[model samples]
Target: MNRRNFLLSTAALALSGCTTASLLKKSTEDTIDYQREKVSGFFASVDGKKLVVLGADYHYVMDQIGDLPQVLQSPLKPRLNAEFSYFDLDHDNHVSGQVTLQLKGKVSDAERQKLQMEGFECKGFQEEVWTKVYKVRGTRYLAKGFELPASVSKFNHDYEIIVRESHSPGVKRAMVLLTPVTLAMDGVLVLGGIVLAPVALIVLSNTHWR
Candidate 1:
């Protein structure tokens, strides 16, 4: 190819790469915001006959889903450690357990190992299996969770630092089935940005530059 035309093509590719990079960055930020909104900062669930959680600010998935961030923090104002549970007078077989988790959004290698050992099952047998649509009262968010089986360990799923939890009255330990909505939305944006560059390149190549 001629020198001028070759240089033009190269410049176009560089600009396209920059566009893709920007899109990815924005998608990451939006995804973080979306994650926070979905769980409303925190939540709680009852297990067995005790209050295992109340306002638990736990994240089972990470923003990138590749490597856990070095430092992650809950959105709770002045976040602190908590251990409280109350009765759910509004709903039967339901209770509110308020737990303050101490997380800086960082998980170490040791922590990851501990979690793997804990696994995602309980008692090697979880019963009363069923599915339900759990909607966060004030928002339009919905999640599907399952009742944790009779746990052999104190905590059904011993995550990074989640240890022996309580099981409140009539409340059975159930796992919440969640979807990465924000990530999905941002993904579309990234994809669109990618398509644009190729189309731009094609159009440019066809234009009369004489």
Candidate 2:
């Protein structure tokens, strides 16, 4: 091919490759969305507390859900029709002070009671001093708490308190479980790219020559 033709062919191939890459990216995103929608159907939460519906792996839920589904998203449509009731003593419009977090999950009454009691033991605190307690009624679990040193001035500060079962080991255990799954995902993606590369090259070569 002449110099102009060669450059034009290269440009055409580059454009086609870009288009294919974009389509592949779109497909990956669609797959992620499908997984999220499916997972959301089973997830439930209440009063800023989340009950993640875990698979056998358990860790995949966090990977698929991405960023621990926030408290507000629980009640929305297409997701679980769960209810959340927030009992805020400091009605000062700030996230501070004596907020009760209740969660209803699929578990036996005995297990639920244990979780409720353990989950109320103030995991972490921010800005203000706080204490938590759990109340159980049949199958539901309630995490009642008091956040003290409530904002005394106009200077507003935001804080969070995470309460979880001590025995559970919390986020550290979660990360350990997820590490293998994350690595596997990376490996699979790499293998897929290796398998597709030659096919992509051939298609680009044919299109570019045309």
Candidate 3:
């Protein structure tokens, strides 16, 4: 191989090996702290079948609805309608891990008790109203009062059972597991290319030298 090609191939092989090792290590790590993913969306159902509908242009989180079909088919369905307003505590414009989930609907005493057991508080009869003000060009505008239920639980976003009503645990795990494998495979291909490139170059050099 030419000196340049040999060096490049060696670098590629080293990089690929490093990448694969890192991915495998990350996959096995048990101490990874996944920050909360903030999302604004509707967690609703049709005829008792539930689904999570995220706001347009927002990213869908695997931890949120990765295994949607399974959750829909599971026996643990909540009778209460869920309104989730996820606020970005870090203002990163990405995933918001802090969430204000408000549940509203008629519930049986048993259901209420179940929710209570799960750390939901019963704040009887609540409503929320807020006015949004903005300016466009030289004109100022007021987006008049919008309303929401005052009953809310501010919690660090984890895959809660209530949120699980529209999520699948299996899918999230699969997605996470597949990513590193795919990357490793790509790295292997690059390493293979690195090996082949040098051999081809070496053959070409020998033929020309002869």
Highest-TM-score candidate: 3
What's the CA RMSD for each of the models? 24.7, 25.7, 26.5
- Write out the backbone clash pairs for model 3: 38-95, 38-96, 67-168
Better model by lDDT: candidate 1 vs candidate 3 = 3
Candidate 3 C-alpha lDDT tens digits along 1-210: 999999999999999999999987766463333233332323322222223323222222222323332332333233322223322221122222222223455666665565555445656555321111111111011112311122322233322211111222233321211111011232321111221010000001111110
The local lDDT score (0 to 100) that residue 168 gets in candidate 2 is 17
lDDT of 3: 0.30
TM-score per candidate, chains pooled: 0.23, 0.22, 0.25
What is candidate 2's local distance difference test score? 0.26
* Runs of candidate 3 exceeding 4 Å displacement: 1-58, 62-78, 86-94, 125-210
Lowest-sum lDDT 10-residue window in model 3: 196-205
Compared with the true structure, what per-residue lDDT tens digits does model 1 show for residues 1-210?
Answer: 999999999999999999999998776554321112111222111111111111224322211111111111222223222221221222122222222123233345655444344331112223311111111111111233422122211222322222223344465545533322221232221111221000000011111211
* Each model's lDDT: 0.26, 0.26, 0.30
lDDT value for model 1: 0.26
List residue ranges in candidate 1 displaced over 4 A: 34-51, 56-210
